[model samples]
Target: MDFALVGLIASLILLMVLALKGMDLLIAAPICALVVALSNGLPIFATQEQGDIANYSDSYLGGFSQFLKVWFLVFLTGALYGKLMEYSGGAKSIAHWIIEHVGMKRAVTAVVLATGILTYGGVSAFIAAFAVYPLAASLFKQADLPHRFIPAALALGSVTFTMTSAGSMEIQNWLPAPYLGTTPYAAWQVSLFTALAMAAIGIYWLNRMIHTAYQQGERFILPQASIIASVEAEQQQNVNPLTAVLSLLAVFITAFLFHQDYSNNALVIALVAGCVVLVVGYWRQLSQHFTKVGSEGALGALIAGANTSAVVGFGSVVKATPAFAFAVDAVTAIPGSPLVSAAIAVTVIAGITGSASGGQTIALPILGPIYLDAGANPEHLHRTISLSSGVLDSLPHNGYVVTLIRAICGESHQSAYLALAKMTMVVPGICTVLALYFLA
Candidate 1:
């Protein structure tokens, strides 16, 4: 009935059509943005200034610019580091190590756990998935784990939850950049306790799915269970282990350097640092896998990063909602209880976006201000909201889950909803209980 409600509904309908019809986002997003703009009585081409090659973006262009201004460098830096890891066999090495060391049965669990740790350290989810997925799939098959669990582990490990918690080196949390007009550093922080609690929720959810599969007799097949043994049978590569070790350390070193406050541009640091390691340790080996490694790395980035970029763009679009002011107004209306306001605000924004990053885009900008005005620790508020985005966006049907299901197991949308239910409702419930405890 209401105009704002209609625009919102239309936007949602577009997302559904895109999903069901296999429409491209480049087409879907602009079309949807136009609809929202027109429905809200805003001109689609308000940029007719001076008639000089007029630009055609809603006010969202301004928001998008701001989003990019803050995040582009971070993303590029992340991408570069990710690219280097791929070049050095670092990513494959990590994946292989997890499978061989953890074994098939426990590998799924280990990979998921590793993702959480890396995510909490501020790596991008795109990088995490790329780094882990190839190996995780083989691990899944051997453990009799469902192939679908590959994406599940990667997404859960990377995207939602403590992975985005404030103070995490992970880019997802910081993608919101300036929340409520405050710099990212202003958000309070993600406590170790909160992170542990969030991680517990994730582990429990995965285990529950495992039990369900056990009951269902779901088929499990590990395609590369013998990869490591076979490779070793041919003799370890002449490339020294030290080379691989340092290449892997690139990520760890970068995370350590930025641990004090996550302001540094990770891409530049990772690249320069990774390059040095690759040169000194196994520079020659680079040629051995040149074309193959280069392509695989980019493929990883493209697959994971493409979806991420869209969600990033969507955040830009929604931030321009005519009702954005109204949304901010509503968040400000919460009286007396700051904690309740934070919980509700984070949940709504995160749920709507199907992206923890997008939720921060909407919620942090508005709610961050409210909390600051109320004298809440800016960092704390930021961190809590960031953490909130992860839990809220864990819906089974979200892009992350969808990608996981399709990539690993050929699951149709219907089959993956069970994991979504477990994570969205069950995991968040546990996290919420703990959140209240922490706040009190």
Candidate 2:
């Protein structure tokens, strides 16, 4: 038992360390699984049962394959939908329209809201960040706000209020359904309130940060020559805004209408329908690179699916360990409402994993059944779990944060991450507590 505990700790630390260092999760996951298997006294590849238990291959591969079987289509369709939107200029068009109407005075709000629109419309968060950055840069420059705050604005918009909110097309919103037997719209009333509160608080805090920075004599500086040239080239394209609006609306309408009937697969159908709409509505706009776009979408889906599946595989091995059982038992035994307990457990695991969706995928397989058995409301559990996952998963080591801060915006963590923490982690954490109070 002591050895199992040590192994669990070692595996978690190794996983987080490697993931934060930017190692491919596909490589890191299997190695972590090996750590757990060795500590648990499990055979690595024997099909024969040890006593009544299955071998490591069965548990690890079982989790990996199960997630793929149930969710490959959703991942494929979501990624493809995002790619099609990117290729059709729909995403950029939407961002530009929002910025145009919002104007420069409210530049931060404009960027945040624009990102929210694209994210809820099924564009990947990474893609949304890329699509919105140029416009955000321009808007910040016009407003004289510091450029460093751009990541916070983007993270707040894309990952916080919109990503896990009810009716979100993001995978985080869809992942709980299979485990809870609920729709992506589960606990929507509570979800709506929580999302609004998060937005309100986050925006207020974000503006305060910008105001403080402005008072400190910090202001927007011109981007690199290469970045400006790239942004200029992108803006030179001719794309209609109406077509973009309609394409996004197609996704929302289809998903909203069909979600109840199809469950998790509803997202698949909606994404497919949205893709058809984009192709038909923007055929002339998309014709030049349609084949390349499709291929890229497929490749992107593979990468996204593989990353998520690898974590699920790691989770499978962990759950089979005695230490995992002990931890779950300890968590479930916590006094107070089960909702609070669920929130804490999910948040901690998410912090450990550094991926919101990955954390939920892992915690739910074990936590879901236990919470349901304790008579916890599945809707409440689902919503709380979803929101909680977003809270700590935005830690500096989080995949999305790293991507936004370094890769996308080209800013150091030291300069930009505090504001991000306020919007994504601090606000969301408070919202989670409020949600537990109201919904539980």
Error of 1 at 186 (Å): 8.3
Q: What TM-score does candidate 1 get on C-alpha atoms?
A: 0.79
Cα lDDT of model 2 by residue, 1-440, tens digit = 99999998898889777866778888888898889999988788774455546557888888888878888898788877787778788888889888889988888889989999999888889889888888888788777889889999999999998988988998898888878988788899999999999988988889988999899999987545214445445554467767767767888899989888888777888888888988888898788987888788789878878877787788778877788788888999999788889999999878766678878988988789988988888888889889999998887656678778877887877788898888899999999988988988
- Quote the lDDT for 199 in model 2: 86
Which lDDT tens digits does candidate 1 get at residues 1-440?
Answer: 27876786667667656744556554565566666666666555644563532122734455545555565555554555556555555555555555566666666467776566545543456556655665665556556666545555666566656465545556655554544433334334335565566566676668677768868987654333222323223222233345545654675576456534554454346545655676566566565765654566556545444554555455555556666557656766778557567867777666655666666665666666667777765555655565566666755336655555554335555655567456544565566556655553
TM-score per candidate: 0.79, 0.93
Off by more than 4 A, model 1: 47-56, 117-123, 165-167, 175-190, 221-271, 288-317, 394-399, 424-429
Assess each prediction's global lDDT (C-alpha) against the native.
0.57, 0.84
Model 1 worst lDDT run, 10 consecutive residues: 226-235
lDDT of 1 at 73: 54
- Deviating ranges (above 4 Å) for candidate 2: 1-3, 47-56, 222-233
